[model samples]
Target: MSSTTSNIKFNRRDFLRTSSLAGGGLLIGFNLFTACKPNAKPPVDLADLNYKDFNAFIKIAKNGAVTIFSPNPEIGQGVKTSMPMIIAEELDVAWDNVYVQQGDLDTENYTRQVAGGSQSIRFGWDALRQTGATAKQMLLNAAAAKWGVDVNELSVSEGIISNKAGETLGYGDVVEEAALLEVPGEVTLKDPKDYKIIGTDRKNVDIDKITTGKPLFGIDYKTEGMVYASVLRPPAFGQELESYDASDAKAVPGVIDVIEIGDKAKKLLAGEKVNWTAQLSPSAKVVVIAENTWAAMEGKKAVKAQWKFASPPESTEFHDKKLTELLDGKEFTTLRKDGDVQKAFAQADKVIERTYESPFLPHNCMEPMNFFAHVTDEKIHLVGPVQTPEDAANTVAELLGRDVADIHLEMTRMGGGFGRRLYGDFVYEAAEIADTLRKPVKMVSSREDDMTTGVYRPAIKYRIKAAIKNGELTGYYLKEAAINGNMYGLIPNFFPAGAVENYQVDVAKYDSNITTGAWRAPYTNFLAYAEQSFFDELAEEMGADKVQLRLDLLEKVKGTTDERIQYSPERMQGVIKKVVEKSGWGKQPEGTYQGFVAYYCHNTHVAEVADVQLENGVPVVKKVTCVVDCGIVVNPLGALNQIEGGIIDGIGHSMYGNYAFKEGMPEAKNYDRYRLIRMKEAPKVETYFMENELSPTGLGEPTLPPAGGAVANAIKAATGKRVYKQPFIQYDEIWKVAEKPVLG
Candidate 1:
């Protein structure tokens, strides 16, 4: 099928100024390079070319080699390879001949360049495709003009254009001519059936570099004469740095300087909106600058600092009590109201009320937070792994009192983000240190610092209640108590909203000194478990099959509400049936306990069935079958990797991940104390994708929400006990304690 976009120009000036490559935005005109070098020839190799500011999409060489710049940060989401594949597919280039490059931070040319929210591919789909198609159309025009034939009479495949007379020419031979030709007002896109590179498996473009231990991640970044900085911040959330003595730190070998960094919260709180609040570490910090990282770390440890309580500190116990009190109380903002929830609950024959709680989760990105900054009078050069380079640049610009244009930000491949790198505090810290000293500085965080001084997934409690009447599901109410925010923004219009007649979502929040932000799937990561587990109990109470009950509710969802439901009931049911078939849902062999879950989030629908077995009376997740409906798969290999990764990550975290605070300080400051899913405990994941022609949605986060729910339910099936709190291992510990008490 043909796709059309607005006319645009390809001149370097216009490309940089107006940013004709802006995705999902209107293009006003169509023009070509009017002042192209008189005898410009495609370079023989990559090194011979000049770096142009505006080759924002695809660039070609005389040997038919193509380089497509991926415009989003690569946080291991595979967009660095997958995004360029979209451009190559429509550019009619062979995958083998295409090279992928990470694009620099060019806010003028790229929209939504941030890597969080799993939106890079979803948001880039249309524009990336159009860019390649536009380039191809121009190439076709050049070929047609040379062959004296209509463009329609020529067909191209793998970067070679063939005329009706059987004469063929490489795209490189016509690229010079194409560069001077006017861009088409609109270009026809390839039909999905004809796509070759998009659906096919392609290895990550940097897999070799990554596997061979190349300098790809932020921690690997270095430069000549660049000093290292290690910082010591407040020990607790509400603490204020009083004074610091850096005499011993300065005397340490290779230690250069120790300086105090002041707080920016007062400036931020003065009615100045500076994008997502960059003062997560708002308290004062002492920075130890040294010739090398070892010296910096040692120097930081030697520094003597004092802190005072500025406010009442918080603890996990306090949070638990406050959340329970909020749930019991009636002070809540109604996020969504579908019908008379109170009346339906009052009229119900049976009401199943369950509260699910999850603790604060650290992103624990494999790479600790680090950034390199060189702040000179003329310009600021910042390099690091960040999910939001644009925001980082802007924030640093504001912090350093420099122009955003003066700040040049480059993104390195991240070890892992999981939503932690979305915040630019680390970037700001590096910039601040460099600006303060007027020297190039690379700020590095120890694993302890990364864990204790990081923005976390808010600790949340979900109280889900279901009303049943005459063996029919009647009402649903979800009340959420979060540390600082609510799930109203993400899941208010999701499933059961349209399915139940009396449905309502209420949210209440407790303000705390502890910082919380997005973590992977955010609220739905744990919410799915709460709602789905409740559904299972609801099913058992009604004496109905779990999968069939979900399907029945989905069936009732048709034409029920005017609000835009985020999920398609048909798609939700499709994955549910597929997972059931793939998992052999009810027919599992003896000793194999299976649980099912279906959920929709991040614009995708997913279903997961978990298989659990008892090992020494301890429930062990043996395997999981996941079925997803995220529309057309871009790359089956990448999609499978993501699905398997999400399942394992979800299962591992649900089973063992835990983070807590005591008196406003994180209890676990390093890996030795913090728990993560180990490789031995990871479940074998069997994945399936629903075949469809619909446009692709997000995959990175959608598959995660259902995994916890499926595993939790399976554990319940295995042990005949309900687990309402996260880090299911706690229950095992409790069981061990209870079993040994009398024996002793």
Candidate 2:
């Protein structure tokens, strides 16, 4: 497919025409015909399109095919299918005719292209529907004018505009005329009851390509004359490059050049203004212009290098111990204070206090981080597995001291993101290396590099206390100490902060040798684990049902508190009720262990129940029952897939996940050492969505937080001892706790 500049020439006139056609409201015209041919090349200068200003476009061609320019990246969360479902609902089109394309980094048409935070569906719920509604209205108006009838007398079905008088026109027959109409500013979106496709199950748009090994991932991205690149970072955080011997590397076949690209030097001399929000650390050495990825790997292994460790060397153990000590101390900033905790504890019939600890986690996305860039004096073209194109474009422009308009960042389907791709550190590295070598370079990270050098989920420790008097919960206290280094700086308002009255919360931090970034639900990941576990403990002490205990607490705090709670109690209760009914919470099979947990995040509420059994002293998850309330479901199958994936991932982290540091460096370098969940270990997942019409919310990260708590609860049921720490009851260490009785 050839590139076209029609968008530029048809800008203002097209916008006004489409708006006028859509009942005199503002409208945005998108070229839907672009999706007709596969592998269509985007216009060279279309990178200048404003993504933040307008939502992406979905156009229907005359042949009933719908093309969607997806602003958000599809990183195994299924936005490619779900986002298109939103448009299809309002366009009144068949799903078979829908086609999805990766949108260019056009700030004019998209916002928050970053795929983290599970915000894709929540943000696109209204915008994508409006885009489709506007187009559909324009087509109907064109048909009405042709048939000399009122538009209200016409309706659209499967890309056909038909009138009550039996006159009809296909979308293709009126698209040229509709394209000439002014874009409507206010298109009436169809109500949820009228939706034909939004709530329906649909297959993933790229599943066929993925399962067949089509070139849809960054690892498969290739171009002629392109060379591979790699970097050697310090084994430990805060360590700096001292010196390196390149003689052996130069002798390696296909090796081209070894360059010292220090982050400090670039900050000072490259005329690039670094944005710390991007979470990039200083890189001291990078090997570029290699023949292939394998050759680059061999050359890197052969190169001799040395590093200087940071002063006052800090390791993961040091940081973990320090955080534990600090939590034991009395001095900490109080985030919440309600009733007198001292009095409540003194008068309580029972006081339960428990400390929970979780280690740092690596994203370990199926696909490792990689980016390909071709930088020159005139312009830069970048493409790869990136979640945020706008941020990438801005950072690349700043790093190269080029116009943001000249730096183009194209997104590819990511194997997975899980908040890891939010940090564009890898993008900067690729762009800088490409600029220096003046050739196209694909910077690839080995599994080891991706696991160790990349940003990690912060290690956290939580101390929770609850008071119960006469089988009635009175007060609660929670204090959390975690590694507060990296992007998302210390967010003290994460959870349990504004949710409870007569409660106290404190958050503290200790610096660590590990570099950290967002993973899945960010602070919510651990907060859910701690808070939900505390609730379970409280329920046991109060002799109350677990679900009933949560419901009562939610009711007690309703409307009598602040507005910053960040969740809807009704919605939370709805999912809990749904899960309870579906999982048969009160009834149990002989020798089966059951655990339940619920959480709210990313504007979505999720509740999960896990059934487990002990096999050879290892916790084996048998099945997971999940209930999600994300408002209107964009794509039922995609939503279900996300929940299933999240549960599997969360189980892996709770049972087998760990990133250890030895002598200030990561001990688990690759999959061999760092374990992951495989198909043989996969448990049966049953997911249900609560029906609603309040617009869609996020699905990806919201389901993850509950998995850990549910699995932990199930393990506690299976074994009499409560496991507070993650990777709970590892098989190698199960013998140490064997004296503890296994409970039914």
Candidate 3:
């Protein structure tokens, strides 16, 4: 972590040995030509490709093609393009001159390469820059030595170094010499003001390939003699395949073998014993060994399987009901506490209490969970569009009983992840099928399989109470209950650790057959909606402005006075203040309704104002004004895109998206049944960023939480009704209300 810079002195003899003649011009492959130089020394590890477990390699080819290896998976979040922007910015190269290659599974050189939590930019901010800067310094040192000029007087632009005397050399000419010099302990990184490419809207690096329908995803990856495999699981959450007649399945075209994969083998190979008691029922009997995806799919459809549904029909219903019941319980974990809430409520002139409920949601990534594995006697190659590649690699290596070195994982650009790719179950499933078949196999989940197979965002219930007197906020209480679904084991300590006083937050788990995992924004998605909605209600009851009320309450906990509150009040206020100015909060437009909400998460603060108008009883969101303080913006256009997309997606999830269960099975199947916000339904979105000197935070998930609250609050303002549930106000209901126009 220590930064260092040292002056490198290179003599004339060193320069000659590193230069080579190629097509009448000099061609230099740093290490290759170093031996021929006049006073050449042994090749130096100038850029310790092995330094501190570097995630990627930075190489300057003889032609000045600056190649960068990106370790993190890029799933349409623009990391494939934005991350290289950071490198080019520091390397002082033109964006067009840079080429990016996805890194392989190299645990020794790259650790912690999993991509999620919208942390790609933040993680690359330092590492990639340092790498580029170090390489740039080496090249400059070599050029300065060859020109017999001071290194400080030499400037580099677009991979070329020019001196005050007008003598210049392309990076390709000095790359060899630079490669022979000692790697600098520290290199000076460029300031943001000096950046030429970052903050600008650059086209995605893989856009052309994607647009032309090139093979850029896991589904497109194919190998010689590769076979496709599919698994058939029970239809219901707690159902198990008791028996199956695969005789007809084996008769299907291209059927190679039929092997049953059970929980016993999965447990033994995975090193974690199967907890039969914890399972809703016995694991499914998987049939592996196939010719192609279509063949397997067809065979699966023809197979007759007997499944036993052990879990009761009320499994989901019981859990949903339990969440509501917990909201009324007195005993709960205290997240924040200040004055006695009971005493404050007794003294208050008015007490307003309301409860809100949110249903479970599915990630429904564009690319369903899939993995391609080629397993042999010596090594195994796994490729996929996964969020957690490193974790997946390790799990596969361990399950195969092979050294980690024998496993190679290549992460392809995902269609969409949204936290769904964080799970490695699909990776394991593919590896298991490959190992069982002893061949290269790709395990692809059908849309139905992807939806029904466990892991969803847990349903939640919230109870909010606010005590007001003389139009001033005096006290507040919030209680939240949901299934225990923190995949990373972080939620139990999240809310209780900070900002609010007299806040009781408790999570209760009612054992159910269904499994749950992370969705976009996780708990914050529901928490912000509930908290912001309740705040809106409280503001109305107190006859106080919503923004002013929040500001007043925020002033009390502005600074980092408490360790539990991990958000910056100043950053929060900055976004809030910016949105207010940009949206003209106090100005009212005829036939338009406005509502505002702000939240802090993922180390970023976002405030949004939503403008809406009823169109024939349907809520038509006209525009949204969003202000964010994510510290230094990396790519302004990309950041804005993230905000805009998150807003639109959030709107859909809030007003129309819902995943319910009937008889222990999800009712919604696909986009047809599960509604999504289409292009025509999209609202006009305006985004603004706060000016700040702080380091960049995250932008992807921060804007999502406020969209629901902002829209709900706006609805409440237009109509004297409170929406306590998702998809609460239907289009037909709104139309009915609009038809009864008041006659003055």
Candidate 4:
């Protein structure tokens, strides 16, 4: 891991300049593209308090209190904390003095304010560092000018500047002068080794709010003269609203109005290009508006609605059979083909193949889908917990036939996203409801509503085959069959691509009415389990250690066509080796079954080992060791929280999470039916971060992919039975005869 710095040049006109606050303070604005341009007018005039002019920003009060605006949505990924930490670190400010505030959607200043793909930290790194560095440089120059000393002779630490003569000044004392100084042309970034706040542990800035149940989540949003809306969506995926009688709903106490809103499909099917985010807006649904949430919910329950199939209804059974048939058929698209796989398999000594299957899954975010919208003739104001606020605003704008400039979106903390909030359909629906009533409305989705009528993780099947020749691995082929969509765009270039000489990847998809989109790591979530489990079997067939087998394959990938690879082989190997040493792989005590898996995705490399103990013949995950190489963790505490959360989430869903559809209706409406990992079942996680100078990648998703694989392998070691399907309890025989699990 090497440290790299951007040599950004900034002229007086293009530098990230400062402004005098309404109060006696300094407000610094940073824009990576235009703010640091060589020759251009500054994006924002340094005379006013205009916040929309910069992608990243810092405000220092005269009393030394610092406020940093986090430009990305905070979906429990800790960006609100980590993003500001970067600025505070470079600003040489005390961590205690820093206050982080979530910034509203300002496309004029921000780029990539999205929360998906685990890229918030990676993409915001350089600009955020430069923002603080630029501010600090200006402050240093101000102190130098006042003290009649060279800037190079001044040293600053935690908002205090000192000279060799022992004279000291607080940053507050010089902030006014700093605001008036011209921005430096170039600013130097601190070396990674000199970092103080980045590598050290820092608590989430919102931890207190979250734990204390403050009004930080979108579900907690409220406004005056606002009505609550509960919707009645079509029960089935292919169903369309035909007629609705709101007589009973209107009779309910506190009920105000019931209205039907048409789906965006009309515009979507017009054969005209429309906003992609708006395409996910809901189908025809009856909205019940009332004075309160309880009234709205009750009114919705009382409403009588009639639905008819727009097309053929789909079921899990139909999807499973169709996907299986697609796997056996010749109709497929070649995503990637490295060599002649057919020829390599022709003369093979042995061929092994396996198919893995997973059911569709709902996100089931803790805070059920909800958004507040105020629609008037002039503007549309939306406030919610959305991952892509910019996209949400655009989607609303498109759906309402309004200009994007007239839509303003504010982001509140999300209880959980897990890729669910990436779509702006809910936001659009809220705006539609409010626009129809010409008033402010807060739309809420019941747990059942979201579970049954929501964007889901598409059900998928993978057929993976490997051909061996003379004890050497020769060919590898993977065929993916999915409902609605295929693997993610970049997955074809992931692991085992550059490692195999005759590697090939093919995919086929069934266009179903069931809506599907990104779910956490997306395709890699289950693909990792399928591929890593297959690799374990491949290693066994080759009479090699599973861990060593991965290392050997990575060795072949290193330096050979490395540029095309999405992940670093060295980083992958580093985590693998670290997890092995830390977990004492192959040296576990008696009755302990250990499984190892290494994976790379979300621009991060991770290796995990699950330790299983059979409790009354049922495999119990007792502990897990996870080693990550995300590089220069901005906040070790937050990073640890993400790793543990990812692993636990992965294990929970892989073990008991099963959402089935029968005749286009979700089997489980809520947690009463859907199973989740219990507190007693959670494994004690030992987390370790591979120290490196490389820029940080993503931690929110990468660790999750390997968790399922490691746990499944551990169960196999414990029971000599392999599980190929998600919700492992359904496929493994040990779970069939085992008594109720009891915590050890």
| Alpha-carbon deviation at 196 in model 2, angstroms | 1.7
lDDT of 1 by residue, 1-744 (tens): 334343433543343222122221112111212212334322111111121212246767665677777767899889988988888888888999988888789766654466766665665666567677877888899899988899999999999999888899998777667766665756777888899998999998999999999999999999988999998988899998888899999999999999987555345545375667375455778999999999999999999999998999999999999999999999999878888989999999999898888889999888999999999999999999998787778778777667898988888999999988878888888888898898889999999889998899888899999899999988999999999974356567888878888999999999988878878886788888889988998899999988899899999877655646767888998998988899999899999999899998887899999999988776788999999988878988999989898888888788778888998899888877777877898888898899987778788888888888898888778778878888777533522442111000
The TM-score values for the models, in the order shown, are 0.92, 0.89, 0.88, 0.94
How far out, in Å, is residue 701 in model 3? Answer: 1.3
For 695-729, candidate 2 gives per-residue lDDT tens digits of 67787878888898998888888786677887664
| Candidate 4 Cα outliers beyond 4 Å, as residue runs | 1-6, 11-18, 33-54, 263-265, 268-273, 279-282, 731-744
Per residue, candidate 3 scores C-alpha lDDT tens digits across 20-129 of 33422222111112112244321111111111222545666677777766767887778777877877887888888888888776665565465666666665566566
**Residue 175 error for model 1, in Å?**
1.4
The digit string of per-residue lDDT tens for model 4 on 278-357 reads 54533578999999999999999999999999888888999999999999999999988988899988989989999998
lDDT, candidates in the order shown: 0.80, 0.74, 0.71, 0.84
State the RMSD for candidate 2: 7.1
Clashes of each: 0, 28, 16, 0
Best candidate, TM-score: 4
Measured with C-alpha atoms, the lDDT of residue 626 in candidate 4 is 93
